[model samples]
Target: MSAIACASLSALVAPSLCRALPALAVAPRLLTAFPTATRQPAALSRRMVTSASLTPTIEDILVEDHRQFGEIMRRYNLATEKAEKKAALAELIRQVAVHSVGEEKILYPILEKIAIKGDAKAVIARERQEHKQVRDMLYDLLDRNLPVGDPLFERDVEAMYKYLAAHCAGEEVSDCPEMARFFPESARREFGKRFLAVKKLAEDQVAEEILDMESKINL
Candidate 1:
């Protein structure tokens, strides 16, 4: 989305949506343009990194997660049939788990190595704790056989989604610059490939776990 569209969106939406819309609108541009405002010329030159050299920094990846989460929330709100909602919730659970694990496996370690004081390692550390808590809730949801909208499951899923949104914010504001610093061009290209490979492995692991659960249930 363009700046004009964002400005238009801000005028018409509630404050909360207004705040969130910028990331939704601007994220793709940020990935491509890597705007000077969010990144420093020195950082870019020091790294000699171009947009194509990296797939997406943790910020970009998390922005995509937020977009997906927002879509799921919107679908859940609009769903009328119990079956449909349940299916949507199941899909949401799958996506969120995959996203979280991929980030933890591929992104956080890099952040921990490069993070500096003003870069908000404290916030990122707290967010990592939140990820563990949220992952526990997701695992509980995975183990349950209950219907969708079961109070406990719904509560846990909502909590996890909320945590993700806040977590994404911290990463974008606090940890993004560190990414530019840590992932200079050659390193970014190599890490980008590794990140995707790890994410694919994580997805396969989730599939295997689901299969194991299904076998145990004779389903």
Candidate 2:
């Protein structure tokens, strides 16, 4: 009779123990389902560096510009009136000018040294010429307050935009590859440092100029 009673008690207690053990184990997991904080965004300097000694490539710079330029183009396309178009055009010009300055300050000299004549020089030179052409067009757009549908405004800005897109694509595919192939590891790094320094300086100057101009225009 005593043995029978102990068996009966054991059967009842085993199921309860199993359920309690699982509940205890799973409690912490359930509690952790609440939202939690995350790490802050990475810094720009930290992002571009891969290895301790590796240099940033022209491809990297151009790729960044492509992303930024695409956004500006989208904004321009969405603009409604002359005022909106003008604002978009201003932003586009500002971006292109800053980008050109950065490339000239940092990228051009490096490519000019490594690239062979005819193909390389012409390619790089053409990009510089495009920059000048676009700058002139941008100046015209800004100086003259014309309707968005006007032929002059449409022709100049669209031409500049098309030229810029093609130029950027060529740099990423052809010129940048040549630059990377020609330079030594150390040379690449040195070039990258110089480019970054000059790029920063140019960006600051562009920003200041834009702010002053905007202030004058009350934009």
Candidate 3:
């Protein structure tokens, strides 16, 4: 949203509806511009590398993402102040939301195309369901309809933390290794490069999500 518009909003509504824009904040309602679960960069390239590889595979990259998620949670757990915890949670939500885009759009489809384990479809379905649950929990935490002081807010945060930890463990042990088994080093690296590129494209959306959730944390 334009500065004048946001200033007017701040004047007319609770400061919480439109706080001072953070360094990463984009236009107001930018989060609403993209669909909740499917927000992604339209121009993300799908090219594959044909040559032998010298770098990490998609499995490696996915593991790194899991590690990052774990670290975010770790810090959130350590945080004492409400502002600190909310800020960390906003970032965690943003990272998880964007990370799902590359994994679902780019990585999971290979398994759908050809599966030696015969459970690719079932696995993808389960993973997608879990991703939806995480997204929903974040929305519940910030939903304006809920009592601003509701105890459910704390319950949802703790529940999501446990749920996300288990989800990451599943991907780290099972899904990521499946990526390794399915693709050779060169192909894996090529797909990994593409996934990373798409993630970069989602940077603005990530920032918008963080700002949106942060603004909603009135507690």
Q: Per-model C-alpha lDDT, please? A: 0.51, 0.52, 0.56
lDDT of 3 at 193: 71
Give the number of the best model, judged by lDDT: 3
The digit string of per-residue lDDT tens for model 2 on 11-82 reads 321111100000000001111111121311112223455775666644455566566887887787787766
TM-score of each: 0.61, 0.61, 0.67
Listing every candidate in turn, what is its Cα RMSD in Å to the true structure after a full C-alpha superposition?
13.8, 27.5, 15.7
lDDT of 3 by residue, 1-219 (tens): 223222321132211121111111111111121112221221112222235554456666676776787888788778777677777777777777667766666665654554434454665556666776776667776785443335676676777777776766555555655555444566667667777765665566456666666688764
What would the per-residue lDDT of candidate 1 be over residues 1-219, giving only the tens digit for each residue?
A: 233222321232222100000110011112221222357422332333347644654445555565677798779768877666766666665566566665666566665544445334555456556666665555555577655567765675576566666656545554555555444544544455555565565566676554443332211
Q: What is the lDDT of residue 147 in candidate 2?
A: 59
Q: How far is candidate 3 from the true structure (C-alpha RMSD, Å)?
A: 15.7
Best by TM-score: 3
Judge candidate 1 against the unseen true structure and give its global Cα lDDT, from 0 to 1. 0.51
Better of 1 and 2 by lDDT: 2
